[model samples]
Target: MAKHYIDTQSLGRGPQRLAGQARVADLSRLVSDLPAQGDLVVDWSVAGRADSAGRNFVLVQAQGSVVLQCQRCMKPFEWPLDISNEVEVVATEAELELDDDDVEGPDRIFCEGRLDALGLVEDELILSVPYVPRHEVCPGNQPDAAPEDEPPAKRESPFAVLGSLKKP
Candidate 1:
């Protein structure tokens, strides 16, 4: 499907809702961080709302699965993406700065009239990705497994050598 851009101010005023499916390939920011192979599926929904303080906010929900290279085994693994967030829309950087100290509240986003729904989805997906992706149990051979031809190494303790030198 073609990309969609919404007027942030109008959407916030009406508190509109948007839902769609976007190919993972189309999300450049998300695709760059993932492994080259495999198909990914992304489903997303966004809604506009006004808080009690009359601040414009955007609610986003994005779910999908992408193949990631496991850091442990260096192999591809399927990782699910589920992101749900509500961001207060601010007109200027100063507004965001004012809200920065309010860490306990929802995040704040600065919108310059137009908001890119696809880019928002991509950002959410990227945030959902783990710092290090790995399976609970590796799908292939254990990474630390020793070669079959190599015998396990044995070491003599320093204390044993000292004891031998001080034999009674």
Candidate 2:
């Protein structure tokens, strides 16, 4: 059976609630706070998988919508995030190794005691953010004006030339 811990010590080997799925709105206090302080509402209806190696790995599968602003249109919209991630929870880099997919790697989050699902979710969402997030199209977007340096030139096509040659 899996065991839950509130400290860095590793408990007996078994299945636990390491990975979770939840619907959250604000993550300001969750991620910024070091010990990962926030409430992560796990949806028991949605099944998730969690694997650990000496308290180093925690994989979570989450699916929910996050409200974000469209970088192009400057309008807020809800973007659904289908979360399937493996986050490593560890203390030092020396103890990290790439043994399993969910094994917390060298560049992983380290916790003192309790697992902060809220902070983990926030990090995942931020990483998933697109560099250029925009809707299909917005009304505010307009065609760019031609540069002043470039001069316009008129050219007649073959069809136009043939029409000109025709009498009438």
Candidate 3:
């Protein structure tokens, strides 16, 4: 069985915290089965809040880092993540819409009044990746450009000059 990421749903009503480690890969999968390599130590703390509908929610502050491929270079790199996010998991869409007291953004999603913090952790980590991947220093230097206006000139080979010399 794969190791389950520590869940922190119980903390919505009060200060809650969870700490665990998972692999850097398997990030795309909803339930990541992290490899035995480096594990990302995730630490999350939530101070509960109430939405517009008076439904209780949690304000999550997560800090962690994962190894991800650079969008530009396809090379493996470490991406650090420290986010102050507020996710209001309400009972229904109407409740979320009617609630006007808190700031609503696309990050908000309606669930069955249950917060799956592990899922949220996976998503936020993925969102942190840059669209373009690039290496710090790409291999191979740029080719030297010849002067465009210069006419073609015949160049003598060093071997040809050596061949013309007669040995005594």
TM-score of every model versus the real structure = 0.78, 0.51, 0.54
Q: Rank the candidates by lDDT, best first.
A: 1, 3, 2
**Compared with the true structure, what per-residue lDDT tens digits does model 1 show for residues 1-168?**
576676777753577788898878777777786777356678999888766677888888998888889888898888888889988888898888884677799888889787887787778888888988898888765568779999987888868877868857
- Comparing 1 and 2 on TM-score, the stronger one: 1
Which candidate has the top score in TM-score?
1
**Clashing pairs for predicted structure model 2, backbone only:** 2-15, 7-113, 88-104
User: What clash pairs does model 1 have?
Assistant: none
* Candidate 3 local lDDT, 1-168, one digit each (tens): 133332234344445444454444445462243223265565655445554545455566667765656555555665566867666565567766664755545345666634555566667665654555555664443456679998777898869978768697
Residue ranges of candidate 2 with Cα displaced over 4 Å:
1-8, 18-23, 29-55, 96-107, 139-168
Query: What ordering of candidates by TM-score runs from best to worst?
Result: 1, 3, 2
- Indicate whether candidate 1 or candidate 2 has the larger lDDT: 1
Query: Per-residue alpha-carbon lDDT of model 2 for 50-94, expressed as tens digits?
Result: 344355555655566555567787776655566667655666655
- Candidate 1 vs candidate 3: the TM-score winner is 1
Reference-based lDDT, residue 91, model 3: 57
lDDT for model 3: 0.55
